[model samples]
Target: MNGDTAALPPHRPGSTPAGTTDTSHIVQGTPAFRRTAAALFLAGFSTFGLLYTVQPLLPEFSRHFGVSAANSALALSLSTGLLAVSMLIAGLLSDRIGRRRVMVAALLASSVLSLATAMVDDWSTLLVLRTLLGIALSGVPAVGMTYLAEEMDSRALGLAMGLYIGGNAIGGMSGRLIAGIVADHWGWRWGIGVVSLIAVASTLLLWVQLPPSRHFQSRRSGLRELPARWRSLFADPGLPLLFATAFVLMGVFVTLYNYLGYHLMAPPYGLSQTVVGLIFSVYLVGTFSSAWMGQQANRYGRSRVLGICYGLIALGIALLALPWLGCMAAGIALVTFGFFGGHSVASSWVGSRAGAMRADASALYLFAYYLGSSVAGVLGGVFYTHWDWLGVCGFVGVLTVAGAAVAWRLGRRTQPATGELALSR
Candidate 1:
């Protein structure tokens, strides 16, 4: 059972009144806002920490399981792929069952699955567990932003979203670092096991820290009505571009990292597995940029900041093509900064534009986001095999250019959308 204390009245399915948004919104720095932020921070941490713990272990998997580089990437790409698809259903379930229940269950269940994954010996069984873990992970990301948008004060939403994304950056970095270091010493199984244990602690923290949803009102859009919400989300003039942006950004980001480990491990640099993992600690840059640039977007304009971030991403990709390892590390740092910053702006922008359709819009963005990870991640290996790092950079550079184009066009026409709270207030 969800440990909620009934902070808000329970609205029955199909019983949301037209003016349901008239409820209170949690402003930043208040106790409720603090609790909400802390809860979501832990949620973001655990979800991504568990999801990406295996990334640094891909090389080990290839050695032990006797798989190709591309096949090894499937361990991660498959989870993200299934997560992309399952997010839609999970969002709908949250709309019916309540955000707390879906997210809490997602955290606990996925944590357990991650632990179980460490015990599996067979590659096929490992793949199966990862796949299920993806499905189990769906409920949180699908619903967390929606919950924030629905409950947080409109003026403070951007910063709250930024902090959430910041948690993701740290969690992702810690998982990769810890796993890589531990795997180098103890083996991949123990690496994964350690991450799973951290996830368990994070889950418990989330259960206790996240206060019940104070502004949530149930909207039971049954399975039959799901298409209409999808239609509504796609019909928004700007949302489609934002979805494409998610696709481009995530594709370029994942593709760069997917092969970089191999490149570093094999190159003139000849870094150890532990040092290679330490490079991922550059994600600390992302942790800063996501929060800082989010507030910048809020203060200036999301589109304006987003367009600049796209340019930064391209610039970063270009730098990676250089011969020196120092250049490559710097490039990765820039790319991490840009990717997380742009993600923060775009994600919060989607939530702001979604109105009552926040969950559906978020799901669509994530669907495209992880879909890019799955598709481009594997495809990048082909580029690496044929043309080397230059080929990978060129491919991602093209995607980054496309993203910049979308952002430029989007910034030209769309204004910041004031949320439902503004109308109700």
Candidate 2:
């Protein structure tokens, strides 16, 4: 019934190979499901919490490292780009190994790297360690989705995924906020260490709480299958559009935050790091919005909800032009809400659409998503230079419109996604 496709496969999550007791789980909306989802939410919180903690520290980085916008961006961009690449491997390994183990180890290892990055004395050393951390962080983002598809009931998958993405919203916002606040008071290093400890705690919780995968199969993976899987995914007509949407949406979102901090910190606004950090508390709304949107998508369908979300995004961008500080903050909140909602819906839909290749499909979507972060995160620096905040808004606004248009097309496109329309060459 999803996407109005009658030919849609049974929405049920397939179990692991027959009689695989270690992975057998029932998603009967029980207390167990809530606990599992909570464990996964913490996993997401840890994953993104570790991944984006450095964002608020950018100004301090500039002072300590004496780098320009683009160069300083290397700290974050390198992490996301490396994380993006690592997803491909994580996908392959999860298919061959198991989702729970891969995710657990990924969380643990990344926490170590994050702690290491915090201790580094020089920017060069920090970037090097952060890139490594980014690579290590890739494990969770890569396998989390396939785990949901394999374990959670299809009926509950949308809401489960929303909570997970909601966790991401909270982590991302709080990570940046904490880094900014802690760095303002203690130091950036302490901020990073604090979040790393949080991640360690979350990893342990995930290890004890997450049920083993019941629906996944350890398919023999060779280097050969990777390219073939990529080929198969790209062959889908719907996938290319999905990938493009991922790229544009993520690109615009990262770009906005990357420069917006600098804008608020500079003359005219002259906000302190702590105040700027409070801006990140706006992420709470995103957390709420993502979960709400997911429930709405389940109730009304993704297409309509996606359109509304994107429209809100465009409106949010326009709000940035306002002169008042309150309006600017509200603008940011709207954008945050819109992006998370759109992301949750799009990411969940990929699992449903791919049918069999959920890991690879998730990998591809994440690949686009993080690459957009790296590319646009740096590119927005140019806009930040010329027209200041307004210029940057103009730059991201175009991308938002393009993304919205694509979302509109995706909602209305009824060209049967089965048979010949399965994939595009």
How many pairs of residues collide in each model?
0, 8
Q: Tens digits of per-residue lDDT for model 1 on 88-193?
A: 8998888777888889899999999999999988999999999999999999996888888877777778889998999899899999999999988998998999
1-425: candidate 2 lDDT, tens digit per residue: 01111232333444335765432444547876898789888988988888889887887888888988777888899999999998988888777767887888899999999999888888889999989988988889868877887677766787888888888888898788888899999999998999999889889888887865545667878767788878988787667678888898888888888887888899888999899888889889878887788778766777678778888888888888777888888898889899999888788778777877878899999999999999998888877777788988998889988887887777666344432132211
Top-TM-score candidate index: 1
Q: How many residue pairs of model 2 clash at the backbone?
A: 8
Off by over 4 Å in 1: 1-23, 419-425
What lDDT score goes with residue 234 in model 2?
Answer: 79
lDDT (CA) for every model shown? Answer: 0.86, 0.81
Worst 10 contiguous positions by lDDT, candidate 2: 1-10
For candidate 2, the TM-score is 0.91
